[model samples]
Structure formats: structure tokens, C-alpha cells
Target: MDENGKIDTRTAKGQATRDRLLAEALRLFAIKGFEAVGTRELAAAAGTNIASIAFHFGGKEGLYGEVVRHVAATLASLYQNAFAAAQAESRAKGEEPIRRAHRVIAKLIAALAASNRSRWMSLLLQREFITPTACFDTLYEEAIRPCLEEFSQLVEATAGLAAESLDNRVLAYSLFTMASAFSRNGNFLRFTGKTGYAPQDIDAIGRAVAGFIDKGLRPSA
Candidate 1:
């Protein structure tokens, strides 16, 4: 950017600066929240000047908004891709709808678990839930709502209820909570006297969660 703080992110160097700022901003904002993280700290963390934050994102508030947008986009992509792949696999194998839902939940849990920044992302989301800002709408509309709607459709198919029905919506939300718990397992770890989970432990957790959900959704013989 020039002295006037006019950002040109189309260029390689400009884009790199913007990316670094966003990366560092996400970490800081997730850990310390938007109000607590100052412009100087953000710039120092990103190895850029304060002017770059203003040029690239307008200001600290603007940068926090962009960080939320970035997080929303990332989560939306993960949810969509996991759901699509699981649905496609189910169709190819002619699996039942309940089983398909189970597969989707399992894949989503695994994907979230495998994300390097899942804990940070979860912390950010918890903040949003506890204290919503204008950006929370962006996250809900872009990521959370879409995923809930799609998962509700899956729940409807398995449970033979309308997707918009209260029961179906509750079921969908509950299933999602179960799947996403792996990403926010700090409380669980502390309670269980465990430092962390291995890959196999995550896999086992996924299977156990899916089994309970599947049993709950199964129709009486």
C-alpha cells in the first residue's frame, strides 16, 4: 500500500501482507477477543506495520470483521464438502438415509478434528455465541444456518419428519453439537484427566457418537 493507506491486495506482496495479518489476527482475536487486541499488537504479531492493517482491512474493527468472514467461509467449505462427499458415497453404495446421516456426522467430526486451528476456531465461535456482534450474522448466514438447514434435511429423511419441524430441527442441532464437540474438548479433557486425544481416540469418539445417534434415529422393528 502507498502512504495514503490504499491497499492493493491483487499484488503478490500485498496479498501476502493481508494473509499474514488475517492469520495473526485470527489467533489474537480468538484468544483475547477483538476489543482486547490492539493495533500495535496485531501488527507486531503479523510482522507488518499498523498502516498495513488499516490499508488491508480499514482498521482493527474492520480486520476483526474480515477475520470472522474468513472463519465463516472456511467452516462453510468444510461443512459443504464433508456433507457432499458423505452423501455421494452413500448414494454410490445405496446406503440407507440414517446411515448416510451417520456418515456425514462422522466425516464432519473428523474434518473438524483434523483442522490445525480447530481449537482457536471453536474459541472464536464460543465468543460469538456468548456475545454476538454484527459479524455474527455473517457467520450464521454464511456457515451455521446453511449447515443446519442441510443437516435438518438429512434428519427429516431419516426421521420421516418435516425438515422445519421442531423435532427435526432439534435433532439436527443435537447431532451437530455431538459431532462438533471434538473440536471443543477442553472441558472433556480436563474432566477425563487426559492431556489430549490421538487420531485413534478421535476416531473412536466419532464411532461412539454416530452409533448413539443412529440408535436414536432407528425406527422400531
Candidate 2:
């Protein structure tokens, strides 16, 4: 790895091998977890030699860390455009933070739902959150904390509260958890008699989530 923490393989073939290792590691880790997976299994799964892991990632632990980074980058890429648009819209003149926040929350929920194709990614995250390892800090810093901070700031702005208030943070987490619950489970689709998260279904769910958050965030007279 280099100063930026990226694999520093110089060859295209080496980079391809490294990429394959990370992909296979994520799949296996999401299923068997870190403890159960071994170097041999990872190498065989990636169709590379065991030494390749050491060369590219240092070892299993290093590979796992890279896997977390891979997941973090992948998920961030998925929502970057939508989140960027919301951020820009919120900065517009006469824009209402509360309403924009609601829309952001809705888009987030829908994005998560659309991302269900990578169930393994969420399962891996669930495991990390439940039983963290040495790489938990990397995962938190790279993925979870940024999201929480973004939501917290949005919540503070939406509610016209002092920055970093406990209430704002808690509400932001609650909203994220609510959306995450729907994304992590298949029960939502089963209950709704839907086989897949089609575009129309995602849109309706997003609208509903936006309405719910909007209602909940408003102050009573």
C-alpha cells in the first residue's frame, strides 16, 4: 500500500488481482465473517495464489481493512450525486432547510432500497456494528461517522437548533436507523407483496418516508 492507503501494485494484472481479492474477500467475509475465513480460502476464491494476498494487502487482516474501505467507497459513490444535489439545493436562496432535509431523508431511504442488490454489503456492516473488530475504526471513520455528521448537521439546520445538539444528533440517528431497517430486511417487500424494489416502488416509499419525516419534525403550536 502507498501513503494514501491504496494498493500500490504497478501492473494492470496486479491491480486486477488485487481487485479480485477484495471483491472475493467482501463476499466471503460478509458470509463467514473475519474469524471463519482463512487466507487459503480467500486466495482460492480470488483464483490467485496465497502470496498474492500478502503482496497486495499484507495479509488477511490487511485485506479485511481494504474490504471495509472498498465498501465505504462503493456506497459513497452510490449516493454521491443525490446527496450532492440536496446539498446544493439547500444552499440556494430562500431554500427551506426543513423541507430539503425531508427530501434528503427520503432520497437516502430510496437509495438504500435500490442498493439492496448488494445485500452482502449491508450484512457485512451489520456484523461490524454488532461485533466490531480492529478494523471497526476504519469502517466507522470512512463510512458511518461521515453519514452521521451529515445527517446531524442537516437535523440541526432543519430544526433551527444549536449545532451539534444532542437532540439533533439523536433525531438524525433515529431517521437513519428507520431507513436502514427497511433496507436491511426482506420483510418490507414480503409484507407489501412486492417481489422487488422497482423504480415505482422506490419512488412511493421515498415519498412516504419524506412525508413521515416532515410530519415528525414539525413543531406543534
Candidate 3:
């Protein structure tokens, strides 16, 4: 163990290098947009040699894939944990399953808001959607599809709707829309004289979102 009483210096250094690359990559991607940035530029921005990307990630495309995968993995873990916690909470309170599902969605929004990296991921995802690339399929499979399936299941089980129910799909899409609006349109909202929500506003947004979805999913009068 090193002086820090943890892993040795070599392992720590390796992790630091990887984190430096990710941080630089994220900054460049957010500022210049992904398609516009090149490998050498990214290396220079990260204060490393061009060969580092090749060594660390196999090349530019591989690095991009890694960046996307990193974010996707984080989000998947967040959602899974949030859902599990919501389920536990529901069981503890003896609440209806549907209410538990709503609670899960709220937890998800709160999780997203709590992580700046997640917010960056959301922005990067929106950019990817707007400009389809080879990485689109990778992101969709790794991140989007799983989340969609989970949300669908939560809605179906909670609302007692069929797997193929149009209403379930609509509800899932609406939730996605709501989440994306904050993520994708946040800057636009600020520009257009609307509220400039910070990371702390995530819970409030989540509450509002849960309320909206609950009202929509209610049985028709």
C-alpha cells in the first residue's frame, strides 16, 4: 500500500490518468461537439500524447465508445438502485405498487440531477440523437433500451396494464419526454427567460413529474 494506505501508487496513477482523459474528453465534447473534435486535439487538451488514447482506449472511436459506455453504465446502475430502493420503501409503507413506481421515477430524476456527470451524459445523448452516428446503436443498446424496458415494466406492473398496452408506451414516452426536456432544453429555457434550475432542483422536478404521470395514468372518469 502507498502512503495513503490504499492501493499502490501504480494503480492509483493509472486510475488518475484514466480520469484525466475522461474529464478532458467530456469537456471537449461538450464544448466543440463530438464529431468536430479529433484525436490529436483531444490528447492535447488532456495534456497527454496522442498515443495515450490508442494505448488506453485503442483509438478515437474506441475512446468515444468508452465515454458513452461509462455514462451508460452509471445511469443503468443509478436506475437499478433507485428502483430497488423504491420497491423496498413501498413494501415498508404498504403502498400500492403503482405509487411505488411513481416513487421510483422521482428517485430517478433526483439521481440524475444529483450527478453532474449524468447531466453531461444526458446532454451528450441528446446531441447523439440529433446527429446520428455509428455510436448511436452502441448507446441505444447499452443505455436507452434497458432504461425503456425497465420503465415500461414499472408502468405496466403499477398500472395493471398489458405489456403491449398503448397506454404504457405513451406513459413511458411521456416520462422520457419530461426527463429529456430538462436535460436537453435546460440551456434553451434559461436563454428564453425561464427558470434556471440547478442540480438542487432535481427533487422538485421529480415531484412535479411524478404528480404529472400519476394524474395522467389515473383511470378515466
Instruction: Rank candidates by lDDT, best first.
Output: 1, 2, 3
Candidate 3: C-alpha lDDT: 0.75
Clashing pairs in 2: none
Task: Return whichever of 1 and 3 wins on TM-score.
Answer: 1
lDDT of each structure?
Answer: 0.85, 0.77, 0.75
Residues 14-81, candidate 2: write the lDDT tens digits: 88898899889998998889999999999999999999999998888899988888887766665465
Residue 50 lDDT, candidate 1, scale 0-100: 97
**On a 0 to 1 TM-score scale, where does candidate 2 land against the true structure?**
0.80
- Which number leads on TM-score? 1
* Cα lDDT of model 1 by residue, 160-204, tens digit: 878878988899898877777777747877887889888987788
Worst 10 residues of 3 by lDDT: 180-189
* lDDT score for residue 182 of model 1: 73
Q: How far is candidate 1 from the true structure (C-alpha RMSD, Å)?
A: 3.6
TM-scores, all candidates, are: 0.89, 0.80, 0.82
**Model 2: per-residue Cα lDDT at residue 192:** 88
lDDT of model 2 at position 30 = 87
Report the lDDT of model 2 for residue 147: 76
Clashing pairs in 3: none
Kindly provide the TM-score of model 3 when superposed on the true structure, using C-alpha atoms: 0.82
Tens digit per residue, CA lDDT, model 3, 10-79:
7776667777888778766755677799988998888888888888888887888788778677766776
